[model samples]
Target: MLIVGEIHTALLPHSRPLTPEEARGALALAVGETVVQWARPVPHTASPTLLHGVDCRLPLGPKPGNRHADDAAGGSSVRAVGTVCSRAVLTGGHLLQGSAWTAVAPPQQPRRMPWSYYLARPGTLETIGNFEARRLAEGYLLADGQGKGLARKVRHDGGTALLDAAAIARHSVHDVLSRPVLDQRPPIKTGSTRLRWAAIADPGEGRAVAFRLVGNDRRRMSLVTGLVEPEQIAAAAEDLAVHDWLLSAVAARIALAKIGEDPRHTLRTLRPVVDHLLHLWSAGARTSRDLEFMWDSLERRPGLTRQWTTMTERVRSQIDYGAADLAAKMLDMMEERQKQTGGAGEPHYR
Candidate 1:
C-alpha cells in the first residue's frame, strides 16, 4: 500500500465534465484484488458549506529505514501519515452541493549520468526496470479531474445525494488500484551452497598474509578452512592449479564484481590460491597414504592411537589456519579421507 504525504488541493478544470468511467478509474486501490471502501463523514446541520475536506490515513508498508540503510543515514524519519485526500460533498442528501479538490504533483526524477559511450553491461536493464516499476506502483495521485462534475451532479440530484457520493467515491478508488506491484526479491540458488573468500595483506612491508573463508555460517566456514596447512602454502606459491569447477566459479564471481563496480578485487586475485589447493591435495595424497600405513600398524596400541588422533587433529587445525580459500580446505579433506579409506572411494568435491 502507498501512504502519500503532503497533499495540495487545486481548482478543477472549469472547461469540461468527466465521464463516470473516467472518475471510477481515478481512485487508488492497494495491491491485490481486494475491494476498497470509502468512509464519508456526516454532514454538519448548522454549517451550510457544500464541500468538506478530510485527510484519510492509509496503512503504508514498513518504514523506509527498515528497507534501506541510506534512508536512516539521511535523517529522514518516516512517521504514520495520512496518504489519501478525502473530500466530501454535502447537499440536502440529493446531489453534492459543494466542491472539493486535491492535487498530486509528479515525482522528481533521479539524476542520471550521460552515457557518452555505449557499453554492454550486464544487469543494467534489469536494475533500471526494477527501480522504475517500484516508483510507478507507489506514487500518489495529485489531481483527479473526475471530482468536478461528480460534485455538481450530486448537488442537482437533491435528497438522493448519498448514492451519487458513493458512485464518485468508487470511481476515485478504482484509479488508485490499477497500478501493478512488482516482486523485488532477488533470485536464490537452492541446494547449492555459496562460498566467499577474502585475503588481507599485512600493513607492514612483509610477505605475511591473512585469509578468511566465508560461508552461510561459521561452522561451514571453519569446516572449509580445515582442509590446508602452512607447509601447503609453499606449494601454492610454486604453481597453483585449481579444478575446472572451482576455477569457473571464481571467474563468475570476478565477472559479477567487475560489472557491479565493486572495489574489492581480492576475490578476483585469489584464483591462484585455488590452483595451489589442487596441487597440495595431489601432493598430500601420497604422503597421507604412507602415514595411513604407519597409522594402521600402530592402531592396536591405545597410546599410539591417541597420539595419532592428536597429530591428525593438529594437522587439520593448521590447515584451517593457513588456507586462504574454504574450497581448498574441502579439497584437502577429500584427499585425506580417500587416502585413509584405502583409496576405495572418491570424495564429493562438488
Candidate 2:
C-alpha cells in the first residue's frame, strides 16, 4: 500500500493568537461536525476531516518537461478516482496547517469502477489500469517546476490532466487562510512551507522514516511503516510536516535578522521569533505511541530538536549581546560628558 499526501503550513493570519473558542469557530469545515481542541502543553485545534472527490490522470515522471527510465514502466494510460481527506490544524493558536492525503492501492478490476464504489472507501485513489506505486510516489514528490501538476501530459502525451493531490491540498490551505474568521493581519510575515510525503506499508513490525529538503520551501518524506492503516500513516506525515515547517520558518527569520548589522534592529526583527515560534518545539507530542520510533530515529541522526535548541540559544545570546552593547555605549557617552562638565549632564548619542 502507498499513502501519498501533502501539508501546507503557515502562520495564522491574525494579529494575535486565537483563543480556543475562536480557533474552534474558525475550523468548522464540515456541517454539524464539532472541532477538536487541546489545551495541554500548548493550545491546539483541528477541524473535522473533510473529503473531496478527484478524477484525473496520475502523473508519470518525477518532473514535467522530462522523462525518467521509470516513466514508461506503468500502463500506457492511467486514470484514478477517489476522495482526498483534508483538514485544518492550528498549533499554539498561531500556526495553521492544511493537510490532504489519499491512499493508492492496486487496481481491484481490469476496468474502471463507478464513482460510488470509490466514494465508499474514503482516502483511497482507485487506479483504472495497472500502475507502479513507486513510480506514482516519485512523480508526486517531484511534481513539476512550479510544484504543481503536470500541465503538459494531457496535451503532449495524449492523457488526461494530472490528478495533482498537492494542488488540492494547497487549495484547502488557501480556503482556510482567506476566511473571514481571520483578521488577515499577521504579526510577522513569513512564507508558507509545503511537505509532500509517501508512506509504504512494509511486512514487519518496524518503521523507518526518511526526510529530504528540496531548495527552500519544498520538502519530501518517504516512510516505510509496519502499520497498514491509512489514518495512522497520515497522522505521522502531518506530525513530521509541522516540525519541519517550524524549523524552516525560524531559520528564515534568523537570516532576516542579519545580526551584527544593527543590534536594536536585529532585536526588533527577532521579537516575533521569541514570542510566537520559540515555544512550539514539542516533537512527537501529538503522535501516537506506535509511531514514536520515526521521530526517535530522526532525533538520533539529523537531530531536529538539537538544531532547534541551538537556534533558540543563538536568539537569546543575540538579545543579551545587543542589550549589553547598547548599555556600554550609553555609559561611555554619559561618563565622558560628566568628566568634561565636572557634573552629571544629559548626554547626546549618535
Candidate 3:
C-alpha cells in the first residue's frame, strides 16, 4: 500500500496572527463538515477534509535499472479511479498549508469498474494494472513532473485525464489564502514550500523514514511504520513538513547574516525569526506517539530541534536584542528558565 501526497506551507498572508474564530472561518471548506481546532500547544486549526474525484492515468513506477520514474513511460496507460483527499491546516494562526493525498491499492479485479463502485471508496485509488511501491515513490517524490508525462499521453489519446495532485493541493490553499479573511499582506516576503511524501505502513513494530531536500523549496520524505490510520500517517507527514519548512526558512534567513562580525545585520535578519517563526518550533504535537519516534530519529541525526534551539538562542541573545524592550526580554528569559526546569508548572510551549 502507498500513501502519496503533496503539502504546501507558507506564512499566512496576514499582518497578525489570527484568532481561533477567524482561523475557523478561513478553513471552513465544506458546507456541513466541522472545522477542528486545538488551543493547547499552540493555536492550530484544520479544515474539514474535502475530496476531489478523479479517474485518470496513474504515474508508472520506475522500470528496472531506471534511475527515475518519469523515464519509465511509453508503456500502456495504467488507469486508477478514486477520490483524492485535500485539507487546509493553520498552525500558530500564521502558518498555512494545503495537503492532498490518495491511498493507492492494487485493484481487486483486472478490469474497469462502474462509477458507483469507485465512488463508494472515497480517498482510495485502486490501480488497474501492476506496479510496485518503490516505483510509485520514485514517481511521486523524486520525479520532476509527477505524472506530467502520463498526463500528456492521456490527453493526446483523449482519455479521461491525469490527476495533478500537487496542483489540487495548491488550489485548496490558494482558495483559503485569497478569501476575504486574509489581509493580502504577508509579514515576511517568502514563497510557499512544498513537501512531496510517500508513506507505507506495515505489520512491524518500528518505523523507517527518509527526508531530503529535493530543491530549495521542494522536499521529499518517505515513511514506513506499523499499521495505523491513514489520517495518522498523513498527520505525521504534515507535522514533519511544517517543522522542515520552518527549519529551512529560518536557516536560509540566518545564512544571509554575519555571525560574530556584524551583530547589526545578524539582528536585522533574525528579527523575523523571533517575531514570526520561533514559537512554531513545537513539533510532534499533532502526530501519534506510536509514530512520533520519526521526529526523534530526525532530531538525532540531523538534529532538527537541536538546530532550532541553537538558532533561537542565537536570535534571542543577539546584540541589543533588537527592538524588544528590556522587560519583555527579561520575561522571555524567565520563560526559558521555567521551560527548562518546569518552573511555570504548566505545559512547556517549546
Candidate 4:
C-alpha cells in the first residue's frame, strides 16, 4: 500500500493565537468527530478527518511539464478511484495547516470498483485500469512549481494524469479560515510552506523516512517503513510540516530584521519571533516514536533547533541594544533641556 498527502502551512490569518475553546470552534469540520487539542508541549488542535471522493486520472509524471517513463511503459491511460482524507490543524494556536492524505491500494479485481466500496474504506483510494504506485509516489514528490503567482504547466502526454491533493488541502484551509472566528489580520507577513509526501508500507522491511527539500519552493518527502497505519504516516507528515514552517518563518524574520536598519524597527519585526515562534520549535515532540529517528537524522545535519536558537539570540540582542539606546537618548534630552534653562526654577529635572 502507498499513501500520498500534501500539507499547507500558514500563519492563522489572525493577530492573536486562538484560545483552546476558540481553537475547538475553528476545527469543527465534521459532525461526530471532535477536535483534539494538546496544551502542555504546545497549544495544538486538529479537526476531524473529512473525506473527498475523487475519480480522476492519476497524474503520470513527476512534474506538470515532464513525463514519467512509466507513462509510456504502461501503454494505456490509468484512472484512480478513491477518497482523499483532509483535516485542518492549528499549532501554538497560531499556525494553521491544511493536510490531505489518501492510501492507494490495488483493486480487488482489474476494473474500477463501485463508489460505495471505495467510500467504505474512507481514507483509502482503489486503483483502476493500470497504475504503478512507485511511479505515482515519485511524481508526487517532484516540484511542479505549483503555488501563488506561478502558472501551472500542463503536460499533454498520454501516459499520466494529475492528482489534486494540494487543491483538496487549500479548499479545507479556505473553509476554516473564512470563519468569523479568526481575527483575519496576520501579525507577521510570510509565505506558506507546501509539503507533499508519499509512503510505501512494507511491514517486514525496516522503517525509514527520507526527505528532499526541493529548492525553497516545495518539499518532497518519501518514506519506506515497516507495516504502519496510514494515520501514523499522516501524523508524522503533519509534525514535519509544522516545524518546517516555523523554521522558515523565523528565518525569514531574521533576514528581514536588517541589523543595519533602525534598531527599533528591527525589534518590532523580531518580537513575534521570540514571543510566538521560538516556543514552537519542539520537533518530534508529538510524532510517533517509530518516526523519531527521522527527526533525529535531520537534527544531526541541518540542525533546525540550532538554527532557531541562533536566530532567536540575535533578535534578543537587537532588542536589548535598542532599549538601551532609547533610554540614553531620553536622558540626554532631559540634560539638554536643563542646560538650556540654566537649571532655572520653572521646573527642575527629576
Off by over 4 Å in 2: 60-68, 72-77, 144-158, 204-206, 332-350
lDDT score of residue 241 within candidate 2: 80
> Can you write out model 2's per-residue Cα lDDT over 1-350, one digit (the tens) per residue?
77888888888889988889888888887779989888977787888888877776665553354565445234333578778888888898888888888888778878777778888998888887776766677766655333335122344556566656667676657767767878889888888888888877766635778889887888888877765577777777777888888888888888988899999888888888898888887888777777788899999979999998998899989988988999999999878889997786765679
Worst 10 contiguous positions by lDDT, candidate 3? 144-153
Q: Could you tell me the lDDT of residue 89 within candidate 3?
A: 94
Measured against the true structure, the TM-scores of the candidates, in listed sequence, are 0.14, 0.87, 0.84, 0.87
Error of 4 at 133 (Å): 3.5
Q: Model 3 over residues 119-194: C-alpha lDDT tens digits?
A: 7988888888885766666556644354442122345556755557787787779879777978888777776788
Model 3 clash number: 0
Ranking by lDDT: 3, 2, 4, 1
Candidate 1: C-alpha lDDT: 0.24
- Name the TM-score of candidate 4: 0.87
lDDT of 3 at 71: 47
TM-score of candidate 1 on Cα atoms, chains taken together: 0.14
